[model samples]
Target: MDEQLNHAPCGFLTLSEDGFILEMNQTLLKILNYSHDSLIGQHVNSILTVPARLFSQFYFFPLVKLEQRVEEMYISLEAGNGEEIPVLINALLRKVNERTVLECIIIPMRKRNEFENELLLAKKETEAALKAKHKAITELETTLKKLEIQKQELLELNQQNQKYKIETQKELELARIIQETSLTDPINNDKVQMEVFYNASGELSGDIYGIYQIDQNRYGIILLDVMGHGISSALITMTLHSLFQRLISAGVPVDLVMKELDSHLHKLFDNNEEARHYSTAIYLLIDTERQKIDYANAGHPPALWQDPNGTQYELSSTAPPLGTFEGVVFKTNTFTYKKGGRLLLYTDGVDPLISNYLAPLVRKTVSLPLFQLKQEILQCLNNEKKVDFKSDDETFILVDLK
Candidate 1:
């Protein structure tokens, strides 16, 4: 038993009741960094680095003397290098061969302390990385929310623009209808054998005309050509129509009415910014009771007359167009209608085929009634073999004695 205690793997020592080291094995000697002879006579309290008073007075002497054994108590010892080493100590009081002895075993605690410290450090590192990743994810989510808000705003703006476009188109169509309703027809009287054909290059036109009864035995006719073809020209024609209706309703004379109309038009559009902005017209007043006609031309085509015997005559121009000059006088030329004859007034659009095919026919067939002349014009138009023959607005008014 003594040899086995001396050759133990762990440290073993024996102490007296006075806390002195009575005997120590070779293992205890090497572990405590002391010689056996040096440790045997030393006090155990002197080799321990921990506070020795508590262990000696309260734990080691009382517990071991009364209970005979103390299990797994913690203590500290000093190494040869003066470094402190933590240890688990077990002590017992035993009797062997009629002699009392105190024995102790010391177990070092360094490996467990190192493992707990490494675990704490790894946990701290993982927590810090997780916090950083969470912050990045929060930033990305915020950016996505802002971009979604901007997209919604753009979609709303596009819808508003489309609504405005639809409203503007509706307003434009309304204006076109109003302009069309205001146009006056020259062929409504039974005494006038007239035909008018009008086609615009676009949705709106610049051509306009009207026939009015001046008195119980007199009639007035007008054909006007404004500058352009769309909304601007349409508005001008509307204004002219209103002005003429008002004058005729007030029973104004044809000559004075023409003069006043020119003055008003010149004043209204003299400073107009558009370069090609003016109106050209022809006005004629016929006294059917007296068998005579009085006419004025302002840069318009000549009027044609066909007698009952099939003789043709052309009435020429006398003045410049309306809105061209202020205070300009319009002269009236008088001619005998010669009972049973017809007078014809027309716009430039009427003879589209005159230069193409009807010129030779007109020069050859000068002896024809006004209706036959119109038929000739239509015949020349229909003879064209082309599929697309676009023509301008054609208007013609023929007057005969009742």
Candidate 2:
């Protein structure tokens, strides 16, 4: 598939009759500025602007179905980076492996040609309208001058917006880099092994995790999901990242850590209601020497724990999320650890129905080899069906205890 279609000059996409994308060429993914996983299982409407989607639904699909093909149908696609691209698409219905699919070849229109064509069409339409109305020459000249001035102003405004967009993108990229750096490297040693996966819906994420060695035999792990998305949430995560490092490095108790976090968030947002945001977090302190785990869950999803004997336990929420109220106290819960026991900690983005989605997977795969378990978890998360519903940042930490 890559050798034949990936390098084609024009973008290509194959979709189910219902408009779900089944296959896409590299060219289309590049043109849309989207990753394969992001678009592969999504609907055709995912890439179309609202009007373009309506056009496809009302006219494009019906015409293609009647004639078995469509050619030079102009539409605008919304790129992953939020740019709208004007395109001319040719589509045909075909059978592949006994299943019917809609195959499309999309050619992006050159900006100059698009603008010139629109201008010419508009001019012709206006001239005819003016002649029918028998308008005076002076009136027509005044209207043309006004339209030209407005067009020039619009062009200048678009240039300024484009420049600002580029600058904002660069800044967000830098902030993303900084946030990624704050994540602790995965730990693999004789005592315990850890693996992590993180996926953000956008350039900046509201989820953050860290693993810290508090002492020779004690390790502290934390995962937090801030409310909402974008710059505000990302900024809060960064601020909490620093505080989490300070508290965990000093070996703050799990319950105290949760309390301090809640307090900090309240203090941080006390004045501004609009800017106020909260976080759901879980803090775990693993004592390898004692073979025990102490954790405090602040309204986050339960952490899945499976013993060596295949028994699973859920460390459920023990307190409200941070900043939900003033001076909230947190309670610590303990779970006995055993050899070959595995623990899974994840943010809610794993699934909106968090309990139903994760519990069965953990029970079935917890006893498998670590590598296989990791693969299963990741494959489930990356499934096109699952990706279609995901709207928040997804993160998980899998711990293997020896």
C-alpha local distance difference test of each model? 0.66, 0.82
Model 2 Cα lDDT, one tens digit per residue, 1-402: 777788798999999988999989998899888999988888998999755664576456766787888766667899998788988788999889999999999988655455555556657756775876677777777767755765675587578557656755775686678778878988889999988898888998999999998889999999999998776688788778889899999999899888888988888766556557899999999999999999999999988898887788888898899989886879999877888998899987885565656778878876577768778887887784554864779899999989
Clashes of each: 0, 0
Error of 2 at 199 (Å): 1.0
- Residue 263 lDDT in candidate 2: 88
- Candidate 1: pairs in clash: none
TM-score of candidate 1 on Cα atoms, chains taken together: 0.52
What is the lDDT for 208 in model 1?
Answer: 76
Model 2 worst lDDT run, 10 consecutive residues: 110-119
Query: Which whole-number lDDT from 0 to 100 does residue 18 have in model 2?
Result: 85
For lDDT, the strongest prediction is 2
Instruction: Indicate the residue-level lDDT of 355 in model 1.
Output: 43
Candidate 1 residue-wise lDDT, 133-169, digit = tens: 6557656555555445554655664574476457546
